[model samples]
Target chain A: MAIPTGPMDLVYRVLDDQLVDVEGQRCGRADDIEFDGGLGERPLLHAILSGSGTWHRRLPRPLRSVGARVFGTGLVGADVIQVPWDEVDDIGSVIRLKARARDLGLGQGDRRRAETVARLPDS
Target chain B: MKKVLQLALGIIAAIGGFVDIGELVFNAQAGAFFRYRLLWAVVVGVIGIVVFAEMTGRVAAVSGRPVFDTVRMRMGLTVGLVTLIASLVINLITLAAEVGGVAVVLNLLFDLNQSTLILLAVMGLVVIVYFVPFDGIERIFGYMGCALLVYVVAAVHLRPEWHQVAQGVVPSWHPSALYAYFVVGVIGAALVPYEVYFYSSGAIEDSWGVKDLNLNRANAALGFSLGGILSIALIMVSAEVFAPAQIDPGFLGTTALGAQRAFGETGLLLALLGMLFAVGGAAVECAFSGAYTLAQFAGWEWGKYRRPREAPRFTLAWMIFFALAFVVVETGVDPVLLTEYAVIFSVVALPLTYLPVLLMASDRTFMGDHVNGVLGNVIGWAFFVVILVVSLAAIPLMIITQGGSG
Candidate 1:
């Protein structure tokens, strides 16, 4: 019933989502997570986070490139991609989001988002 | 705590976000034309911006989305597209004026020719904006923008009747129509829609959530109210300087020169600084506003706070937007004409821009438990109605008045 979070708890939605490791690296965010309510067993949080590709289907092709650019191809190791829970040394003021930011494949999917957005009305 | 620093950031951004080229030229213009009699409209605009900015900041903090995102989800594609086009036009026009304004400032300070400096200034802004950290740029401009307060000092030096200015706070049906027009200009300049766009998007860029609502209110009120104070000072100075001379200011340069009437060389430096930074500050806000609106419209990750590479699409949109302003400026368009068109177009887009924010801020889906409280709704709706009326009359008024010069 309790999620061990403070302000950070408010940062998310659809609580109990999975956060997977970055492709071939040790970092990623909670793309999807599941929680089991078994009384006798230890409460388990299975977060399923991959790369930006997880949200790619909803995005059109051009939009997908935006995701790829901001995240990564998920085929190679990079910063700005998803950061897994383990790689998070801690949640301080800065997201400390797996300090390997220097190596992340930034802007990998920018074109995709731009294209998809351009096609839509900017309401 | 660190939260306090963040709150300070919000306040600073609010200061930078409060007034723009419209206020710079129009407010001073209002003073030159009508003096304290039109000061009420400035106050009305100030209150309107504060109310709208408050709602927008609240919306951003609660929904974790900027104003455009909410507009898109609420208004849907067709109407949203219309808003974007309108907002973009105003942004470009305002951007042109500010770009020209920067040139004028440099002209005043360095004795450079305005023509020579115009393109150079626009390009310089595009370059700084391309690489400067969004937060850093905002802070620098926001705090330094405080320099414009010297207007208040000069206005006070003249020692006008406070009660007469206070009397203008309420609408007078018995007053001259020209007086009414002047009042409308003050309000029009103050309630410029781009200001609210820049404000709300700035809130999102700062990553505000419900926890920051109080700070949002504080910043909107404090920073904007202070801006109002400076605007009134402009009105007073113009009343004092130009009224006796029977001189009407046709250019922003003349408006800056009015600063000399009350303060001497010291006044000149202060006015120059104010014009330079005021114009510069507005440029930054409108530019980011352009990018944020486009990015939010399409659901792309966008914020000045984010690295350029991280929000590539967003950054590119802004860069392109800035580039377009270059195209407009390089054409040697008159900034005053540009300001006139921009203000009128902003008047046209008034309802579309504010309505969506009012709707979403009231809705539970996006706001969750943090929806608009009673005071916010009342103020928001009241402003909505007023803006609608002004928007309806703006074109006709412009036509009849021949864009206010007639």
Candidate 2:
């Protein structure tokens, strides 16, 4: 696939896309996107943000609290995990990363829950 | 032969999986009250679901995004959050209704304690979800649920006027508010959002790729159309057996009587067995739908394809939903009544649930050359408009009809 050059359509292409690790394991979503630049300069993509509470903040004012209440904050002691844009391997149906989930501190909740689920018979 | 069997099984599963507690009772009520007049609404609603399901299934196959994932992406955070919450609440109510419905069937078959039956129902559901593979679950429930085809045969045996049944294919408006409510209800019940959510996610669960696109279309078209035929058969049976006598098919048992009147004890047994599997399938579907919506929206690792340990949150979500539904059922609420309310609320959520699927299906960025063709767009938009109108008109109709009391 040709690398997307120039401005990328973050909203349509990247934001809300599924995050898959280098090993092709499912991890999380691109809950939010971060950018960095000075006022007069074009902002460069910084990182992708994820975790339970991160996306809720993007909800409108009235629904923000409701989102937070429903989705909760910092599930499994991780409020948010960020992957620098440089680490992004490719963007397609899913946002692929160059690093494994644990390396990027993603999927912490899933790993934690998996341990408990593993103890169950035939799980 | 293997391909043929797979397609046949897929269609059979869709046919049997289509009618839930809501469709079973609602179609019967419509038939008992208005006889064959409301059959057009079933056709309309079934067509709508076919279009919607096909679009969602296609999107999942081509793009690997399920309905809830599309819900968040297209609608954005604010509206998506609202949609998620609304769908989750409605799905919970639906789950409760299905669990309670299973208990209702069990109670009719054997004189068991309602609470104990409800518990047994959830336990049965838990065991199935834990032990059965996805295809096995579909086959067990889908094939068993086909026992409901008894109604089709019974409807024919009862032998209503062929001309009258034909007339039902053309939509006609009746002056009564009760008539309008039933119209809205039959359509709403047919277009329940869980079907699409389950379908799209199931596409992903089955690991459907572009190669499965034709199969997806076949499944949606053939499966749901046959399912619609079952709904029509239900109406025909109820119209023949209950309409003339002025018997209201308000309860699940009442709905089965249409079969009993035609074939005696054998018919009754088939009806109950079918209801058990169909409603049981729905309970499982509803539970998985809730899990899919939450996990997909939140971007959690989810799918029955994953082991319970592999997709822990997803596993827990469905299990929690079943436990919560059991709690709801324990409160002694009427499952049939709950079915009515769930249908009504589900229709209200229909537009939110469907619009994203339509948008994403048509978007070239997501779907590439596989984006909905012109015919798909026309039917998709037309049904979208119909569901929106029905959503707006649903509450008032329910109120005016006093939940179809009149």
Best by lDDT: 2
Q: Model 2, which residues run further than 4 Å from truth? A: A65-77, B8-17
Name the 10 consecutive residues with the lowest summed lDDT in model 1 chain B: B10-19
lDDT of 1 by residue, B1-406 (tens): 6544454444444444444555666666677666666777777788888888788888877866567766665665447667987888888888877787777678778887666788778778776666566566766676677777778888888887788788867765434545555555666666677677777877766777788788888878887788788788878888888877887777777777777877888888887787677678778777878877766664455677765655667777776777787778768787767876777778778788889889978987557778888987888899998998878877777776776775
* Cα lDDT tens digits for candidate 2, B1-406: 5554445434433543458887898888888889999989989988988888889989999989999999988988778878988889988998999999999999999989998999999999999888888877877887788899899899899988989999998999889999989889988887888877888888888888999988888878877887888899999999988899999888898988889999999999999999999899888888999999999988888999999998999999999999999999899998888878988988898999899999999999879999999998999999999999999999999898888888
Q: What TM-score against the true chain A does chain A of each candidate get?
A: 0.30, 0.86
DockQ for the candidate 2 complex? 0.76
Root-mean-square deviation of candidate 1: 9.0
At residue A26, give the lDDT of candidate 2. Answer: 80
The list of candidate 1 runs beyond 4 A from truth reads: A1-109, A112-123, B1-19, B174-177
**Can you list the residue pairs that collide in candidate 2?**
none
